[model samples]
Each structure stands twice: as C-alpha cells, then as structure tokens.
Target chain A: MMGQTAPMREAAKHAILILGALIVIIPFYVMVSYSLKSPREIESNTGGFFGAQAPMVDEYCVKVGNPKEDCLETPVIFNYSQAIKKAPLFRYLLNGVIVTASIFLLQVLIALPCAYALSKLRFWGREFVFSLVMFCLLIPVHAIALPIYIMLAKIGLTNTYASLVIPWTISVFGIFLMRQFFMTVPDDLIDAARMDGMSEFSIVWKVMLPTAIPALLAFAIFSVVAHWNDYFWPRIVITGDRDLYTPPLGLREFQGDADGSMWGPMMATATIIVTPLLVVFMLAQRRFIEGITLTGMK
Target chain B: MAVSSKNTGFWFVAPAVSLMFLLLIAPVLVAAFLSFTDYSLGNQGFSWVGLENYIKMFSRSTYSKMISASVTYVLLVVPLSIGLGLGAALLINSVRHFGDFYKTIYFLPVMAALLAMAIVWEFTLHPTIGLVNETLADGCGAWTETVFSFGWIPGIDGGQSWYSKGCQDSFPLWFGDKSYSMGTVAFIGIWQAFGFNMVLYLAGLTSVPRELYQAAEMDGAYRAWDRFRLVTWPMLGPTTVFVVTITTIRSFQVFDTVEAITHGGPSKSTYVMMYAIYEKGIQQNLMGIGSAITLVFLVFVLLLTLVQRYFVERKVHYA
Candidate 1:
C-alpha cells in the first residue's frame, strides 16, 4: 500500500508542477507567438505557434504611398522590422548594453579594491567601514529615488546617461559580496605576492583578481541582469531623452505609443528587449541562478 | 610593512567609502530632511513643515488608499510567492526525474525583464483579444465549464458559474477593472518573484542533511508528512525567515508592473508606494510628500531587516 501510494503521490506532484510550468510559460508563449503574428491574427487571436506566414500589407508603408507589392511582407519580417524601425529599438538595446556594462564595470572597479581592503588589510576604521556597508545595505536606493533624482536634476545630469548610471555605481551589496569572497582566499597567497615586491595595487589587480573571478562573474551577472531590467531609476532620470532610454524604458515608450494595431510590433519590441538576457541566462543557467541567488546570502 | 598595508587599505577603501556616502548615505539623509519641509526642486526657499507630510499621509484618503494598496500587494505577493516557491522546491526535490527541467522552466520568468514580462502579461490578460479569455471562451459549454462551474456539487448553480458567466458575456477586464487590477498586478509579482525564492529554497534544501529524514523516521515519524513536519519544516526555518523577509522587501519595491501595465490602475487600486512616490514627487514636483513616502518606506524596510537580523541571531541557527 505504501509503495503504491508513494508512486501515486509522486505522479500527483509532477502533474501539479506541470500545470504550474504551463501557467508560467503562457505569457512567454504569447509574447513570442504575438511577435510572429500579423496584426489581424493578433486581433482575432488566430494563428498557431509560428503564425501563418501569409504576407500582410504594411499600413504605414501604404500610408507613405508605397506600392502594394512593395508594402507586402511576411508577418515575422513585418513584425521584427517594424519593431526595429518604428522606434530606435536598436539604440535602446545599445543603451541597455552600455548602461548595464558600465554599471557592472564601475561597480567592480570601485568594489573590488574596497572589498580587498576590507577583507585582507589590517587597518583602522575597518570595522566602521564594514558596518557602514551593512547600514547602506538597508537603504534601498529605490526608496530614496526622489532625493537622488533631485540631486541629479540640480547637478544638471538628468536626461543624461550619467544620471542613469551614477546612482548605481556604488553597490554596497557588491562590495559585501566581494569582501566575503576575498575572505576565503588564503593569506599565504597575498603574502607570497607581497614577498615578490608586488605593490598592494598590483596584488589586488593581478593576484587577488585572478582568484576572485568566479565570485566576480556571479556579481557581474547579478549587476547586469538588474540594471538591464531596471525601469524605475531610468524612468526617474531619463525624462525627455529618448537616446538614453534603456530597454525597459524603451519598451514602456513603445507601449505608450501603441494603438490596438501596434500590439504585434510592441510585443516584438518586448521580445527584442527581453531576449538577450534570456539567451545569456539560457546559455549560463547555473551561473545566472547562482548570481541571482547570491543575494540570498545576505 | 604594516604601515604600508594600512596606508594601502585606506587608499583602496577611500573611493568606495566616499561614493557610498555621496550616493547611498547622502540621498537617505536628504530624503529624511526633505520629508520634514515643503521643498521642491528649483524652489529658492522652503518653510519647515514639521510632520505635515506625515500627518497628511496618515489622514488623507489618497494616502490611505496608497498605504492599503501597498499593504495589500505586499500581503498578497509575499505569502503566495513564498508558498508557491517552497512548494515547487519541495516537489522538485522529491521528484526522481526532470527536476532540473521544472526548475529551469520556473526560473525563466525571473530571468526575463519584469517590465517586458509585465507588458506581455498585459497582452495575455487583455479582456477581448487576450489568449487567456480566448482560451476560456473556447472552453465554454465544454468539460472545463462542467468541472469549473461546480455544478456537480448538487447545490451550486451551473449557469451562474464564473466560467459560464465569462463565456456568456465578456470576461473581466483584468487591468481595466478596478476590482481585479490589484489582484492582477500581484499575480504578475508572484509570477516574477516566486522563481527566485524557489532557487533560494532549493539551495536551502540541499544543505539539509539526508540523515535527518532517517533519524525522524526512526523516531516514529514514519509517514512522509510526519517526517517532513518534524524534519524538513524545522530545518527550513532559517530559509523560511530569509525568504519571507526578502520576498517582503521585493514585494514592497514592486514598481515595474504597476507602472508599466496598470499605471496605478483603473482607479487607484494598484497605486503602490513606489508609484505614489513617482507620481507625487517627480511628476507633480511635490518633493515633500514624495520624501515623506520615501522616509516611511525606508523606515519600514529598515525595521523589517532589523527584525530579520534579530530573528536570525536569536533563532533558526541550529548549528
């Protein structure tokens, strides 16, 4: 009876989990399917997974007085093309890359050295600095976004990439994460580097950095994914500047301009905005998961 | 050597410490001070309005609605997401096959940008053309209706069922209806957040000792339920605490979906605190009110984290 019931229980669990998996996958399925669909198919909610590849008239092209033959394009091509061409989708994606990359790079540049100092060097005020970090961790920057925005506006940095990137440059979480990681490195390693006449700066860059790659990679993933998806900060800072708009901001703008007719291109824009990270995540699933869950260490 | 090390440490930490003061610490102080005054950007002078903002926050109907919306959202998202996360984690842990597959599927939402997912969800939940209602519409007068209507229970009315009602008329305008808007936003929050919690719980589960289950069984907790209650639940206490706190904090910070999809709603049903801050502070230039909200938000977060720290220190450390 126990053996029989156990298998039945396992099957039930699997069935329930599969239902959850389906629910979770539905939007993604809708996103991709809608992106591949024509406006008519989208409105009517027809077209299977890939949508009918039937050529559709480009209303915009026709409005621009293009010939019917010139305006006709397949659903996938039309959706993707309009997604890129309708707005600066590529530019938004590029801004996303630039911002997330700069944020991560600056965070490491500022945080790695501080982490090393906090972990390895014996110094006065070390405890004070660590506790300061602990305190800063509690102050979620989003909560204080008003003051930050006002500061940026006062400094005439609003609507610039600097405003979007400046506030995030100091990641207390990154400093703490790297500090914890650096503590695990053997003291003999640093001492050996010191014996070879390596400057502390070089020791940090050359010796410690090599050993901290795994932790640094995880932090990079965390930072990149975060700033890439970040909307609130960008929305606060990048008012009236389309060029500085990150992916989420860009997608929001697309949604803002959308009529009922624009859902296909809008979804296409969403897919474009969202796909890169999802692709990177798929490629490095374990690392991405580790990077995300690294926050739970707090 | 020691002096050189000390000097290097100071130099190394100098930039980060100063940035921290400028970026993180200063903004918080600015918000705190500004919360007590009638200050707006570009204003030459301001008057001290001690506790006026807070007083208004406590008394105003809009502010009360904001507080209620935020509290409702946090209450809905945190518990439901944590429960679903723990459930998924436990199920995935117990399953002999395809565990990683389920985990990967579940975590996909976490990896996707929330704003983008929220937009996609908006489309998915569209009342007329949406995939969800369309799918439900397709199931009208079918077995799905039969099972969902609860008509088989002998006392329930089949024609009055939500499914049958939806089929007969239009489905609820998920984000358009004030009644369902907050729940829809919270659902999206749960959809995006639970995966992260699941990953954390999965990690916690791995750290639990296999021998504990055997030990519990030996102690007459023979059934899986008994063993789980005696062993698994107790062992997951720290994780439960951590997950609860983190999920609570994240739920509080839910801005993307609310802003992008509902725009604080069909009424103000989805007017979360973050949205309120954005609206009053930035858009309306009411820095004082925004700062008050910010300060309130910061205090709540600090208090919660402090509580978590106390609990972590006082309990859940079996080792």
Candidate 2:
C-alpha cells in the first residue's frame, strides 16, 4: 500500500518544494530584471522579465544639457553606466576586496599561530587561555558595537579605514576551527620538521600553512563572504566617508535619497554589489557550501 | 611531548591573546561600565546614575516596545525559518532529482548581501507599482480569486476572506503599515535566513546513519512519519539545538532589513533592540541608555545560549 502511493507522495513533495523555490527566487528576479529595465517599465510594472531594449532618453542626461541623441541609449546601458557614474562603484568593490582580504590574511596570521599553540605546543596556562577562547566565542562582536564605536569615536578613529578593519582582526571562531583542524595533524609531522632543524615559527609558515590549505580555503570563503556582505560594522565606522564605503554601505548610500527615477540604477548598483559573491559561489558551490556549513560543525 | 617546546605556545598565543583582550573582552567590560553613566562623545565629564538607564528601559514605553518588537521578531523568525528550513531539508533530502538546483536557489539569499536584497525586496513590495500588488491585483475576478477566497466551503462567505478582500480593494502596504511592518521585516528576515538554516539542516540530515533507518524498518515502522519520528528527529538533536541557538542570535542582530526598509518606522512598530542601540548610542549619542540596552541585550543573548547549553547537556543524547 505504501509503495503504491509513494510516487504520488513524491510528486506532491516536489510541487510544494517548487512553490517555495519560486518565493525564494522573486527578489533575485526583481533585482536583475529592474537592473535591465527602463524607469517607465519599473514604475508601470510592465516589461515582462527583461525590459524592452528600447532606446529611451535618459532625462537626467538630457537635463545636464547633453544632446538628445547623446542621451538616447538602451535601458541596460543607461542603468549600468549611470550606476557606475553615480557612484565610484569600482572603488567600493576595491575597498571590499582590500578589506575582506586583509581581514582574512590577518585572521590567519593571528589564528593559525594561536591555534597551533593551543592544539600542538605544550605551554603554561594553555587550558586557561583556551577557556578564554571558548568564552569569547559566546560574545557576538556586534553586541559589543556600542562600546567599540564609543572607543573608536573617542580615539577619533571612526572615519578611517583602520576603524572598519581593526575590530574584526581577531576572530575567535577562526582560532577554534583551526585549532580543531590542527589537533588532527599528526604529531610526527611536527617532530619531523623539528628534526629537520626548522624552527617552530618557520614550521608554522612553511609546513603547517601549506598542509592547512584546504581548511584555510574553507575559512577564507567563510570570512570573505561574511565581511563582504557585512553592513553593520562598516555602516557604523565609515560614517559619511563615501570613499571608504564597502559595497553594502555604498548601496545604502545610493538608496538614501533615491527618488522614483533612480530605481533602475539603484538596482543596477545592487546587482553589481551582489554579483561577485554570487558568481563565486556558483563557480564553487561545493566549497562554498562546505565552507559556510563549517560553522554548523562546531 | 617535548618539554622544550613549551616556550613556543606562549609566544604563539600572544598576539591573539592581546587582540582578544583589547577588542573582545574590553568592549564588553566597557559596555557594562558605560551603562551606569551619562556619557557622550566630546563630553569631558560623566556623572554616574546607578540603574537609572536600566530603570528607563523597563519603565519607558518606547524601550518596552523595543523589547517586544525584538522578542516578537525572534519568536516569529526563529520557528518559521527553522521549520521551513527543516521542511525544505527533509523534502530535498528525500527527493531524487534537482536537489542541488533547489539548494542553490534557496541559498542565494544567504550569499547575497542582506542590505542589497532588502532593497530589492522593498522595491518588490512597493505599494502601487510593485510586483506583489500587481500580481495580486491580476487575480481579481479570476479563478484564483474564487479558490483563494475560500468561497467553495459552506458559510465561508467570500467577502470575509482576506484573499477576497485583497481582491476587492488592495493588499496592505506591506512594510508601510504598522500592523504589517514587523511581519514584513520578519518575512524578509526569514527569506534571507532560512536558507542558511536549511543548508545546516541538510548537512545534519546527511549524518543520520542509514543503518538506523533500516533497523527502524525491521522494528515494523512501515509508515514514513513513524520512521521519521523514530530515526530522523533523534539523530538531528544536536543540529536542531545549534540551529535554534544560531538563528535566535542572528534574529536578535537583525538590523540591516530594519535600517534599510523601515528605519524602525510605522510608529516604531519594528524598533528592534539592535536598531535601538544604534539610535540611542551612536546616532543620538545617548550612550547611557544605549549601553543599558546593550547590556540587557547581552544578558538575553548569554541567557539564551546558556539555556541551549543546558538543554544540550540534559536532553540531546547521541545513541
């Protein structure tokens, strides 16, 4: 009896899952669609998926005293070019790369050594320091945003790029994850390095770092995706300095006073901001999923 | 173990220890200390008002509403997202085809920046020209309207149904209406969040031993629900706990959607605690009350985490 109804049950499950998937895809569809659409299409809610590639006049361009022919361009070109022209989007993407890269590299520098010590090296007060790590993991850094912002403000470090990157330099979860991974490394490998006259510090860089690449790659994905997508810290620290804005902060600034005519460019900006990570994730779905779900393993 | 290597650990851990102290430990202590005094930026002096800010938090309606809004958000987002996540996970796990396709689509939200997606969602939910209303309005006087209106059931007059009423006039201004703002923000929150939880639950589902299911079958658990209750839920114990704790914390820190979409508006109906901290502490520079709220927020988080820890110890057992 169960076998008889199994196909029907499975089809029902698929139907339900399809409905949920459609809901998930709506905003993404809107974002990409709006990016390709003319302002009229957006306001009227017309253009089916991609707007008609109609060569519409950009009133803003015309209002700037340009030629009518010069202002005449397709909505796709107008939206994307206006997005770049309206804001230094390239600079924001560059800052995003620099910040996420620096944070990840610095995290590895700090976490790898500490995790190595905790997992491999025998030292005084090791257990206690490890306990401190466990405790700090419970303290969400965002919760402490009030005090940190106050401290940064008092030191007049609020507007600097340093302020954005400094607070996230020490990642306790990174330390914990690396430590767990390091514990599984055979002690014979470290002893072998020591026998080969490599110093402990050299061993960390030369031997341990190379072997920990897979874990490091996973951690890199986790860290970069997080900081890249992070809006909260950058919002607080990079106040009013449009030059220092990360991608999300830049998008927020773009939308701050955006009127109706700017929807096309605004979503173009969003699509630009969201595209890099989405592209990377698509290219490496397995690694990205494994890297992100690494949190769940803890 | 080499006793000579003992010195390496201290030097190895030094930078991380110092950083952890300066960045993590110090801010928490600073938040605690600042909660008692009226401090502001560029102010030379501060006078301690012991428990005054805390008193204000408990006594004031605004702060009270902030607490309720946050609790309501967590109460709504946590369970719904987790249930949706678990359901999606179970369904996707059981299905034989297109599993990866659905997984990728669901996780798109988790990868995209929340602020950007929230903006897109704002556009999608716009009152007049938005896709939501446009699509809903299309169903008016159509078969979807009658069926969705529940007009077929006896005594279920079509006029009284929300679907019918929406068809009659319009849907609520999703993020603009006071009654609906919190729900809409929570909906966006769930949209961005459940995918992560689903991925986590999917990971958990994989670790459930196949032999246990076979054993359950041997025990005459022929029905799907019976097999699931016997095998799946118990094996997913640790994942469920972790998912709940993480989702709760994530839900508590929900500021991007509020900041971008609502700005805690519709008469502060969506005034969550994180936004409250930002409004008071940073923007308004009311450091005392902000710190007080921050402290209260920390206490709630730590308490929730502690409860999860306790429950995990007592209830979650691996057989």
Candidate 3:
C-alpha cells in the first residue's frame, strides 16, 4: 500500500509539472498558430488550440499587404520584406540599432571611468555622487519626460534623433551596474597596473576592460534590450516623422492606424518586430539572464 | 587610496555628467519652471501662473480618477506578479529534468518583445474570433452567451458576434468599456510581467539551503504547506521584499502595455497618471499642465517608494 501511494504521488507531481509547463507554452503556441493561419481561416476562427493547419507564409504575406505575391513556396519568405513595405521598418530598425548601439557605447565609455573612479580613485564627493546616481535610478523616466521635452524644444533639438539618443546616453542603471561589477574587480590588479606606470585611462582600457568583459557584455544586453524596447521616449521626441520612428514606435503607429481591428496583418507585423529581439535573446541568453539576475541581486 | 594629482578621472566623468546635465537635469529644471507657468508647446513663451496648473489638476474629477486607477493598477500588479513569480520559481526549482528548458520557456515572455506580445494579447483577448473566446466556448460551454441571453449579467452578450456589424452596440468590448478597462489592462500587465519576477524568485529560491528542508522533514513537518511555511517563506524574505519594491516601481511606470493595448482609451478609463501626463504634454502640448501632472506623479512615486522601503527593509532577513 505504501509503495502504491508513493508511485501515485510521483505521478501526481509529474502531472502538476506538465500542467505548469503547459501554461508557459500555450501562449507561444497561440502566437505561432495565429501567425501561420490564412486570413480567411483566422477570420473564420477555424484554427483551434494548436492550429488545425500547418504553418504557411502565404497568409503572412497577404496580411503584410502583399496580395499579388505568395511567399509560401520560397525556402525563406523574407517576411521582413512585407514588414518593410508596410512601414519604413528597415529605416526604423536602423535608427533603433544606431541609437541603442550609440547609447551602449557611450555608457561604456562614461561608466567605466566613473565606476573605476568610485572603486579606485579616492575623492571627496565620490560616495555622494555614487549615492546620487542610485537615487536617480529611483526617478522614473516618465517623471522627467515633461521637463526633458521642454529642454529639448528650447535647444531646437526636438524631433531630432539627438533628442532621443543624447538624453538617454548616460543611464543611472548602467552606471550602478558597472560600479557594482567594478567593486568586484580586485584592488591588487589596479595596484599592479599603477606599479607598471599605466595612466588611469590606460588601466581602465587595458587592465580593467578585458577583465570586465562578462560584466560589460551583461550590461550591453541590458542596455540594448531596454533601449531597443523603449517607446515612451521616442514617442515624445520623434513626433510627426515616420522616417525617425523606432521599431516600437513604428509598431505603435501600425496599431493606431489598424486600431485593434486588423489582427492578421498586425500579428505579422508584430512577428517581424519581435523576431530580432528573440534572435538576440536566444544568441545571448546566458548574458541576458545573468544581467537580469545580477541587477536583481543589487 | 590617496588622491593623485591626475585629473583623468574628472575628464572621464565630465563628458557623461555634462551630457546628463544638459539633457536630463536641465530639462527637469525647465519643466519645474514650466509647471509654475501657463506654458503650452505651441506658445512662444510662458506667463507665470503660480500653481494654477496644480490647482486645476486637483479640481478636476478626471485627474482624481486617473490617480485612483494608477494606484489600483500598481497595487494589484505588484503583489500579484511577485506571488506568481514565487510560485513559478518554486515549481521550476523542483524540476529534476530539463530544468534549463523550463527556465527558457518561462523566460520567453521576457525576451519575446513587449510590442509583439501586446499585439498578440490584444488579438487573443478580442471579443470575437479571439482564441480566448473559442477556448471559453469549448471548455466553459458557451457560458458567455448564456449569461448574456439569460440576463444574468448586464451589458455582456455571448451569442452575438463580437466583431460583426450590429454587434458593436450589443457585444461587450472588453478594452472599449470603461468599467472593465483597468481590470483588463491589469490582467495583461500581470501576464507580461510575471515571468521576470519568476526569474528573480527562482534565483532566490535556488540559493536557499536544502538542509533546512531536510531538517524540517526530520521534524515531521513534511507536508508541502508546512515545509513552505516553516522553511521557504522565512528564507525568502529578502527576495520577496526586493521583488515587491521593483514590481511596485515598474507597475507605476507602466507605459508600453497601456500604449500597445488601450492607448488610455474607451473614454480614458485606462488613463493612468503617466499616460495623462504624456497626452497633455506631448500630444496636447499643454506643457504646464503636463509638468504639473509629472510633478504630482513624481511625489506620489517617491512617497510610495519611501514607505515601501521603510516597511520592506524592516522585514528583510539577511540570512
């Protein structure tokens, strides 16, 4: 009786695990199924839980506004083509890449020195400045959006990419993350570098940067994802210029025009927009997860 | 640790600080000034109005509603997401096989891209032709239609096509309705956010010592609830506090989901304070009113964070 009960209990545990796993997997299944369904099938609501039909790109093309062409036959449908045709997705993507990369690059350039200063350099206001940066992290971006908008307008920088990119270049979160990572860098290493007559910048570039690769990569993933996924800043800064729209902003524009009605095309467009981030996340899952975990630890 | 005569550190920080000052700090000061004036975006200049915007905001009923909605959203989303995260973590931690796979699956939403998820969710929750309704129909036995037809629930019809002509007036538009809009937004918010919190919880849970559980079992407190209560809950205090604090802040700052899902629509039922500020300042170009709203939101968030810190820090167990 005892043996039977134990096996039953183990089976029950497995059942619960499967149930939990299903909850995580179901939405993704729905997203993929909906993306692959024909417009008529989607409209008819014929696709059941797992989708009745196999994945096809023709429906994806029709939804992306290419009625004349069917991409189902091709090995790769170039779904991004349909996406670009509908919106300046490529240009927007380019802008996003530039803005996000620039922000990350500038953050590294600034944060490495500041972090080194705080961790290595003995200064009077060092602790106070570090504390101030931490306090700034508490201030939500929205809290200062209005003020930032006015400041940019005054400088004749409104509607420019500078308005979007420059203001967000120095992230308090990035500074904090780097500082935490820098604190973990051994003091002995810095002492050795100094003993070798290396300047502070040289130490940071040569001795510290290579040692800080994991932290930098971790911070890079965080910075890229945050800025790339950002919509609020671009919405306010890049007004009335479709050419300047980022991916998130572009998706918003498409949704606004479609207005909660066009599911097929909207899903296709969404799939296009999401694929890059998903690809990036998959490629850098380790760093991304580590970055998030490290942030939480702090 | 001695201060060297070298000024390279100053130079390194100068560029960043100067940029931050020019872009972030300078704007905040201008915004503070603008809050006291009657400045609109289109207006060439501003006249000092001396707290008129603040006074106006206080007097408006809509602003009060917005404050309540934002508070409710934050309150509901923070604890719930954290709880869900903890649950997911516990489950994921127990996996003896394919542990990494489970982690990846749970983390999918976090990496899936928010705009895409929001759009997908919007369709999934569509009143008609949505997979949710179809699922409900299959599992719940057409209860929505029955409820609507039997007059069990007012303003909710199940049988009528949710998207077809002549159905717009009869069918319940989940996002388009004022009474249910915030609730809908909160549900989506929870769905999108729970995964991130789950990861944090998992990290915390993994760090818990297994010997405690073994000792609890030895003490004859081996029931699931008993084990969790006597060992896991106490050990997880710090992580819980951290999760709650961050989740609270995030909930207050929620913009992407709102923008993607509702745009604070259906008569501004979903209009949280941030959205209100954005609409007034950016879209409507009422810089003064927008600035006033932003200041109000800032004070509100600051107070909440302080109170939370005080409360949570007291409960956080280092061990």
Candidate 4:
C-alpha cells in the first residue's frame, strides 16, 4: 500500500508540475511559432509550430515598387528579415551588448575597490560609508528615475548613451554583493600580497579578483540580464534616438508600429531581443539561477 | 609609494561613495524637494506649489484610480506569486525525479525580457486570433465547457456561464476589457515572478536540516501535511519574509508590462505606480506631479521594507 501510494503521489506531483510548465512555456512557444509563420497565418492563427515553410510576399516590398516575384520569400525569412530591416534590430542588439557590457565593467571597476575597502581594509568613516550603502540599497533606482532624468536633462546628457549607463554605474547592490563575497577571503592572502610589495590597487585586481571569479561571474550575469532587459530608464532617456535603443526598447518600437498585420515581424523582433538571454540562461542555468537569486542572500 | 593602507582605503571607496551620493541619495533628495513645487524641464523659474499636487492626487478620481490600480496589482501579484513559488518549491523538493526540468521551465520567463513577453502576451490574449481564445473556442460544446461551466450540477444554468458566454460570443479581450485587464496583467506578473521566488524557496528548502523532519516523523507526524506543518513551514520562515518583501517591491515597480501592453489603459485598469511615474513625469513633463508620485512611491517602498525588517528581527529569523 505504501509503495502504491508513493508512486501515486509522485505521479500527481508530476502532473501538476507539467501543467505549470506548459503554461509557463506557452508564451515562448507562441513567440517562436509566430516568428516562423506568415502574416496571414499569424492573423488567422494557422500553421503549426515550425510553420508550413510556405512562400509569402513582402507586401511592403511590393508597395515600395519592387516586383512581386522579387518580394517573394519563405515566411521565416520574411519575418526575420523584416524584423532586422524595419527596425535597426542589429543596432539595438549591438547597443544592448555595449550598454550591458559597459555597465558591468564600470560596476566592477567601481565596486571591487569599494567592496574591498568595506570588507577588508579598515579606514575612517568606513562604517558610515557602509551604512550609506545599506540606506541606498533601499532606494530602488527605478523609484527615483524622474529626478535623475531631470538631472540628466539639466546636464544635457539625455538621449546620449551616457544617460543609459551613468545612473547604473553606482550599483550599491554590486558593492553589497562583492563585499559579502570578499568577507570570506583570508586576510593572509592580502597580507602576503602586501609583503610581496604589491600595491593595494594591484592586490584588488590581481589577488582578490581571481578568487572572487565565481561571485563576480554571478554578479556579471545578474547585471547584464537586468540592464539588457531594462526598458524604463532607456525609454525615459533615449527618447527620439533610434541609435541608442536597447533590445527591449527596440522591441517596443516594433510594438508601436505593429498593426494587426505586423505580428510576425514584431514577434520576430521579440524573439531576437529575448533569445540571447534565454540562450545564455540555458547554457549556464545553474549560474543564472544563482545570479538571479543573489538578492535572496540578504 | 609610502601611502598607508588605511588611507588607501578611502581612495578605493571614494569613487563609489561619491557616485552613490550623486546617483542615489541626491536624486531622492531632489525628488522630495521637487514634489513641493511646479517645476518643469525648460521653465525659467517656478513658484512653490505647496501640496497642490498632493491635493490633486488625493482628491482627483484619476490619481485615486492610479493608487487603487497599483495597490490592487501589488496585493494580487505578491501573495499569489509567492504562494505559487512556495508550492512549486515544495513539490519539486518532495519529488525524486525531473525536478530540475520543472525548475528550468519555470525560470524561463524570468530570463526572457518582460517587455517582449508582455507583447507576446498581448498577441496570445488577442480577441479573435489569440492562442488562449482559440484554444477555448476549440472547447465549445465539449466536456471542457460543460465541466468548466458547471453544467454537471443539476439546476445550474451552464448557458449563462462565462465559458458558455465565451463560446457563444467572442471571449473577452484579455487586455482590452477593463475587468480582465488587471487580472491578465497580474497573471503575467505572476508568471514572470513566481519562478524567481521558486528558486529562492528551493535554496531555502535545501538548507532545512534532515534531522528536523526525522524528528517530526519520530514524534508521530504520520501524515505529510502534519510533517509539513510541523517542520517545513516553520523552517521556511526567513525565506518567506524575504520572498514576500522582494516580491512586493517588484510588484510595485511593474512598469514593463503596463507600459508595453495596457498603457495603463482600458480606462487605467493597469495604471501601476511605476507606469504612473513614467507617464506623469517623463511623457507629459509634469515634473511637479510626477515628482509628487515618485515621493509617494518611495514612501510606500521604504515603509514596506521597514516593516519587513521589523518582522525579520521579531519573528522570522531562526538563526
């Protein structure tokens, strides 16, 4: 009886979880499938998962005075091509990489030293600075975006890439994450580096960095995933500048232009914007989960 | 060459400290000050409007709707997502196989961009051609409709049921209809957020000692529910506190979905706080009113976190 009930319980749990999994995966399925189908298929909701691979005419291309034959292409090609061409999705992808990479690099640059100072080296006002960081952690940057935008506008920096990156450079959370990580490092390691006549800066980069790779890698994933998907700050600052649009913002531009007929291209744009992070997450699932849940450590 | 390590510490932290002051602290102060005045971006000089924006916020119907919408969304998303998250974690923890597969699938939404997902949801909830409606349409005159609409009960009017109504007429526009808009948006919020909470709870679950469960079992906790109540629930207290606080805060900042899909619309049903701030402050350039909303938002957040801290100190923390 116990063995029978155990299998039954396991089966029930699996059933519930599979249902949840299906609901969770529905949007992704729709996103990828619609991106593969034609406008007619998308509107009327025909075609299977990979679509029929049927040829479709680019109505806009023919409208631009191109021959109908020249405009003819497969649904998948048309969707993806229109996604790239209609919007600067490639440029948006580049901007996403640039912004996320710069934000992460600048965060590490500013945070590692401060984290070391807060955790390892003792100095005057250290407690005050740490308390300040604690207080600032309570300040969600999104909540105070208006004033920051105003400040950026006053400095004539709105719509530049700097506006997108500057406000994020001071990641109090990064300092907190690294500081927590640095607390685990042995004091003897820093002492040995000091005895070897390495400068404090060099010790931070060369000594502390190598050991903090796991924590840093986790933080890197967290930061990149965040700023890459971040739409609000970019939306607020990068108004009117197509060149500075991030992936999310670019997807939004596609959404704005989406008539009922534009679903394929829009979904294609969404797939383009959402794919990189999802791919990375799949490749490094454990690290990605750890990075995302890094906040739970507090 | 001769600089002391003690002094080097300040130099190391100086950049971060100043930037923190400049970026985080100063903006908050600016917001607080600006909330009391009629300030715009390019205006020369403006007079202080003492509590005018706040007055309008409290008295006006639109701002009241904004408050209700935000509060409703927070109230809806936080507990539901956290509940779903804890449930998933418990089930996965109890199961022997395929736990990793479920965890990965659940966490996929957290990985994808919210704006993109929101847009996809817009399509999925489209009135005529959406997957959700299409799937429901396929269920017309079937057991699904009968069972779901409660036609099985004697004397119950299944034809007047929501499922039947949807089958007869077109289904409600999930985003376009005001009644369904907030729920649909909150559903997306829960979809995106629960996986994050699930992962957090999974971490918390792994740390609960095996001995405690054994002790409970040894003490004659024969049923699974009994064991869970005595051991698991108490063990997950700290994680619950943290998860609730974080989820509440994130729910308050739900901009991407509202801004992308609903535009705080179908009569402001999804007019969440973050979207309100963006619309009032950035788009309309009504700096004073926007700053006023920002201040109100910061106050709610700070109060919530303070309460969470109080709870953690008083009750939740076991270690």
Using Cα atoms with residue i matched to residue i, what is each candidate's TM-score against the true structure?
A: 0.98, 0.98, 0.87, 0.98
Which regions of candidate 4 fall more than 4 Å away from where they truly are?
A: B1-3
Question: Which of candidates 3 and 4 reaches a greater lDDT?
Answer: 4
The CA lDDT of each predicted structure is 0.91, 0.92, 0.74, 0.91
Q: What is candidate 3's DockQ?
A: 0.52
Higher-ranked by DockQ: 3 or 4: 4
Model 2, residue pairs in steric clash: none
lDDT of 3 by residue, A86-147 (tens): 78878888988988988888788877888777777766566677776766766776578888
- C-alpha lDDT of residue A207 in model 3: 90
Q: Is candidate 2 or 4 superior in lDDT?
A: 2
lDDT of 3 by residue, B1-319 (tens): 4357236656666765676666556666777788899888667777999989988988887787778879889988987777777876786776556666766767777776676677777777677766665555544334544443444556654445333322334344568677778887887678778878988887888778989999999999968899999899988888777788788877888787777788887777788887888888888888889888887877777887787678776866747
Best by lDDT: 2
As for candidate 4, its clashing pairs are none
Candidate 1: true interface contacts recovered = 0.90
Off by over 4 Å in 2: none
Second chain TM-score per prediction? 0.97, 0.97, 0.84, 0.97
Q: Model 4, range B1-319, lDDT digits (tens) per residue?
A: 2349789999999999999999999999999899999998899987899999999999998899999999999999999999999999999988999999999999999888999999999889888899999989989988899899997899989998999998988888989999999999999999999999999999999889999889889999989999989888888999998999999999999999999888999998888889999988888888999999999999999999999999988887564
Model with the higher lDDT, candidate 1 or 4: 4
